[model samples]
Target: MMKRVTLGLFGAWLLHDAEEWFTLAPFSARKAASGGGQVGLPWMRREISEAHAHTAVALVGVVIAAASARGYRTEGRSRFYQAALAGFGLHGFSHLGMTVAERGYTPGVVTAPIVVLPFGYYAHRELARTGVARPGLRTALEGIAVAGGALAASHALAGMLHPATSAATP
Candidate 1:
């Protein structure tokens, strides 16, 4: 049950990412700015690029969750499932936090109530239903989330430190 719920959430996230990448990114910046939002030009592009990266991350998470679900059910291997869930949850939270910090709290306000709330609720309920409240599983989840969070933060910081160089001939 827990695995199924995770899979469902993963699917929903993938769909959301597809919408953001294919629809929102291309025109959102121009629309927001022209509509009187004070967002700067470069920042808009940065937001769009970040959205693309997020889409990629979510796709990876979906694959991991799907594969882990199959393996766990087939072999009674809870570790992989726990690790994948924790990683996906942590990645989602990290990106949400970073977006709030970089963009402003307003976006987080919009997303939290809509996206995070449902995902967190469903995941938590599924975990409880599956009796994954064991200490070892809990510890594994915490560790995986922490490790994934660290990696994500490092990547974001590296990008900040070494931004892309572009041609001047445009």
Candidate 2:
């Protein structure tokens, strides 16, 4: 049951990320400044190149898939899973903050409420349902670090690559 639930969250995250890569990145690219960059968190910034956005999405997908495939029922595994839930929950809020900060739409905002919320809720609920201990602050911090690093790396890598698409394309 824990395995299934964890896998489900991973699947949803993959889909949510797809929305960002396919829809959000391309859409936001048009609005990004031509000469100057915007300010925000590394991953949640307004000027992320499309290549990096897609790369980041793909990397996260790989991580989630690997985590699901490996196993998530043990004590350490449960801690990571719980932490993932909390981290993802925080990620969702980050998107909301991005939206508010920009005073407009932002990449990942569309799916944040839809995909992130339910998955986080169910992931946490399923973990609790299965008797997994809620992660402590340390575990939560670890989760945040892992997720933040993965996402920030993706953004950095995207900047290194060529643009995935032109701003003219719809």
Candidate 3:
């Protein structure tokens, strides 16, 4: 039951990302600009670039996964939950590294990664403890992650193709 709920939440998060691709990409770019410091200053645009509605949805999925883990721990399915947590933790760490490398580690600019990384890590650890993931499940998750990554890349491309302009009347 808890596994099902976690999967459902992740599914919903994927759908939400699809829905917000257009709007969110540009918003993220703009927010990055605002957050990035002036020229020659240590800018932190990468963290800003991750600002998207889908991120909130993903966070919600993390919460659900964690709750599900707690509910299932007695069953000795901790490894499955741990794998899930590891996957997300890796994702977060990668993202954070990208952000810091592209944009200097500004104090306030690093909030998004700082908040989400530990949350995702904890959630995954709990899930591993509680769930029993099948062999096929790992493949499916990899496929889903790939597809989601592609969709996000496309959204970023679209934003670049149709650059937003302040001169254009709202």
lDDT of each: 0.47, 0.65, 0.41
Best by lDDT: 2
What residue pairs are clashing in model 3? Answer: 77-129, 78-128, 78-129, 80-128, 81-127, 81-128, 82-128, 85-124
Q: Top TM-score: which candidate number?
A: 2
In model 1, the worst 10-residue window by lDDT is 161-170
TM-score of 1: 0.49
lDDT tens readout by residue for model 3, 71-135: 35534244444344334444545445654664643222343355435555444444445554333
Instruction: Name the lDDT value of residue 140 in candidate 2.
Output: 69
- Flag the better candidate by TM-score, 1 or 3: 1
Q: lDDT, candidate 1, residue 35?
A: 52
**Residues 1-170 of candidate 1: C-alpha lDDT, one tens digit per residue:** 65455465556455444544454333434434445234422323333344434443454554555645653464323555545545544445644664565464322234444564566456656666666632356745664664455445543543454345211011
For 44-133, candidate 2 gives per-residue lDDT tens digits of 434455566677678777766665554354632555555666777668888888778777777788989998877777776767676764
Candidate 2: misplaced stretches above 4 Å?
A: 34-39, 42-49, 71-76, 161-170
Clashing residue pairs in all predictions, respectively, total 0, 1, 8
Q: How do the candidates rank by TM-score, highest first?
A: 2, 1, 3
* Model 2, backbone clash pairs (residues 3+ apart or across chains), number: 1
lDDT of 1 at 91: 46
Stronger candidate by TM-score (1 vs 2): 2
Using Cα atoms with residue i matched to residue i, what is each candidate's TM-score against the true structure?
0.49, 0.78, 0.37
